[model samples]
Target: MKTIRLFSVLLFALSLSSALSQAAKPATVSVNRIGDGPIITPELDQRMGGNIQGPSLIKVPKWIENPIGQYYLYFADHRGEYIRMAYA
Candidate 1:
């Protein structure tokens, strides 16, 4: 009876630990964009710390103005897009 109780306690502890670890994990945010071609702007580069590489996802708002020039692009959330640019 004592052995069974110990086993049960150990299993409970293990399960609790696993649940906590999973909860502590951070969530990854993905961005999606509508339309083709490149979406590069000074604002995006600034927001990304001037480094646009790897897998990036962003939610673009409608009527976005260019950070460098007077231009606008339609953007929305939950859209996947690719941005390849270099900062100098």
Candidate 2:
């Protein structure tokens, strides 16, 4: 009886810890730089997502440009559609 009680307590504690760990996991998010520059930050990266509606901006690394240094700002919806605004 004592052994069974100890096992139950241990199991309960383990389950609780597991639940807490799962809850502690960080949420994932998509990020993009708004305005007229490149976004370079982990927080921004996490915040980026599809369906982004904003102005024309340039993404970093320089090679992704078409000699004009401009890219449309947009986000992908859950359906993976690119919703972007044109540069004016």
Who wins the lDDT comparison?
Answer: 2
Write one digit per residue (lDDT tens) for candidate 1, span 1-86: 99999999999999999998878567796757778855654465454444433434333444665443333344332233443433
Cα miss at 59, model 2 (Å)? 33
Q: List the residue pairs that clash in candidate 1.
A: 31-57, 31-58, 31-79, 32-79, 32-80, 33-79, 33-80
Which ranges of candidate 2 are over 4 A from the true structure? 24-88
Give the TM-score of each candidate.
Answer: 0.28, 0.28
The sequence of per-residue lDDT tens digits that candidate 2 reaches over residues 1-88 is 9999999999999999999887966789788656985332224544445334343454534765454435544434444444433332
Total clashes in model 2, counting residue pairs 3 or more apart in sequence or in different chains = 9
